[model samples]
Target: MLLAIILVTLIVLIMLRVPVAFSILGTGFLGLVLLGGLGHALPILETAPATAVRNSSLSAISLFMLMAQFMLMSGLLDSLFDAARSLVGRIPGGTGVASVGAGTAFAAVSGSSTAAAATLAQTSTKRMLSEGYQQTVASGLVASVGTLAAMIPPSIILVFYAITAEASVGDVLVAGFFPGLLIAIAMVATMYVGMAFQKGAVPAGQRSTWAEKWKSLWHASPLLFIFVAVVGSIFLGIATPTEAAALGALVALILVVARGRFTTQKFLVAVAETVKSTAMILAIVMAAHVLGHFLTETRTAPKLVQAIEDSAMPALLVMVLIAAFYVLLGFFMDQVAIIALTVPIVLPVVEELGYDAVWFGIFMILLAEVGMITPPMGLNVFVVSKSSGIPAVVVFRGAFPYVVVMLLMAMVFLLWPGLVMWVPNLMG
Candidate 1:
């Protein structure tokens, strides 16, 4: 009955448009007061925020967000996209493919999916459309590639997953590298196939000269260096994730300033944006912590885990169900809010099933990336649509093939866990 109330109330509050963090916190607090007394609930609330913020691992989020902001404001995204265009523009649907490539590269530096979609949309969508690309194709490409922001190293979601799962942030970050790239490649391939079957869908264009390609490549080298320095150090154990983030942010700032892109105005905007985004994420984390405490006190996670364990279905089937749930939830919830609210509940079940937390984290993120492109409520879809003036349905159609690629990728990870485990294993 208590679980029923908690679940129902949370859904009700959410449907009423209450912010997810507040809805979870409010429902949990009310449950605690009713079930365990106000005395118990008050202390938990007071401590939860402090405990959530005290995590040094979480500091990486703000650092990475700031770095992303610097990169976005400083025109690094533009450079990368230009280089990608020069290199791939000759192929069918090449601009769309290049958008995915650029987003993948930007993801290494900018950890936010929405920011990636926005930045890439601002940089490439209009141009792609102007180049005679289909509107749906242009918008869909941005929405799908934007999700790479969450899969790539330095992802804010990965940081939260590390803290919640008590896994290494660096390990989770490193584990993401190959899988992220694989998804990017798959997305590009999907574009190629889509264009191939539907002739004239993506107009072919002239290829750049080798010199022009090299110049484009030269302009993007700063981002390449930052990626190697930051991701490479973490993967090689030369620096902790937090230290790497700080170092990355410094490098990003320098690149922006050296390029004369950073004005006092731009610097202040980046700082302000970072603070606002960080505060929003932190608030959700704190609230989710309070709700997590309540769930733990009630033994909700264990109960669910036991039920799953007793079920007749194979563990793989259960995993698929959970992934599907994330897809549905992703349609309506922000990725961070979903992570904060669901991980505490679902992770125990994942562990009981004998999957590595790091692998599961990667899988979960890949599922969430689908949500970012999936529907009436897929945030990235809306972001790209708004930026590109393309209809949401068109973006949805464009992203449909990529969604299949993601689902297939999820199955691959499930069947061959080595795809995700290989990197972390080697580092060990």
Candidate 2:
């Protein structure tokens, strides 16, 4: 009964526009106090923040964020996009497919989808619109592809999920690799096919000479190398995620220096942004641990799992409902908040049904990313709209096709499972 009321209060808080971290923290602390007394609630609130921040697994977040910042500062992201566009821009969808291609590459560098979305919005969206693509397609493509960052390697969300679920961070990161690449490939194919029916949007491009293509790729090689070093090292079991991230940040720093873009001010700005971003994530992490404590003390997850088990619903059906539930949560909540708030609750329930912890991490991220593009509170859509000067509704419409692509991909991997886990299996 108390758990139900806490959930109700949480919903009420969200509906009232309370900040998510606070909503979660307040409700969790309240529940702890009411159910187990202040003796229980007070200790968790006091310690969770410190404990969560000290997690060795989470150190990668700061390092990866720094790497992203350095890449952004060095203008490597622009070079990478141009390089991708040069390679794929001559295709039927031109900049649209190129955006997906570039987004996939950018995903390797910036774990934050908003960073990818804003970059593409400022660069790709304008070119796409000028190429005669519909505003919805143009804006939606950017918004959709930007979400690639969430599932691709070095992804902050994947790290958060792994830490919360007590899974191997490296395994979780590796698991997302194949599915993310498949989704990118699907988005590219989707773009080509979608453009086929758009009539006037398909324009023949003057294909670049091999020499020019090589030139663009050569210019962008540093970004590629960083991505490879980070991901390859992980896949080969040559480095921990934190070590790989540190290596990535170091290489990105050197790239900034080589480009003559390194200024003390710029470096400090990157550091500041990294700190700010990490701080926000850590606060939510703290709140999650506190809530996780409450849930654990009350044996909430065990009871819920037991009840669902006895209900005798097929495991697969329950899993589908859970996937839908995550998508529903995405519509209204931020992805970070959703992961922070629910992973503690849902992970155990799913694991109880024999789901792989690493697979669930990727599955959770993919579903949560739908919220990033869906209506009412789509974060990526708003970022694209603001940066591209397109209407949010149009961006939302634009993103719908990609959203469908993601959902279909989710179901595919869920059924096959191996498609999502083979790379991790290889790593093992």
TM-score of each: 0.97, 0.97
lDDT of 2 by residue, 1-428 (tens): 98899889999999899977788889889999998798877878888878877888789989999999998999978877678878877766666777888898899888989999999999888887777778988898899999999999989888888887889989998888889999999887777777777777556554677888899999988887788879989989899999999999999999999999999999999999999988888888887777777788888888889999899999899999999999999899887888888887788898898889899988878998999999878999999999988989989987888899999999998898899999999976
Tens-digit per-residue lDDT, 114-230, candidate 1: 988988888888878899888877888888888888888989889888887889899999898889999899888888788878888788865899999999999888887689778
Q: Which residue pairs collide in model 1, if any? A: none
lDDT of 2 at 56: 87
Q: Which candidate comes out best when scored by lDDT?
A: 2
Candidate 2, run of 10 with poorest lDDT:
199-208
**How many clashing pairs in candidate 2?**
0
lDDT (Cα) of model 1: 0.86
**TM-score, candidate number 2:** 0.97
Global lDDT of each candidate: 0.86, 0.87
Clashing pairs in 2: none
**What's model 2's overall lDDT?**
0.87
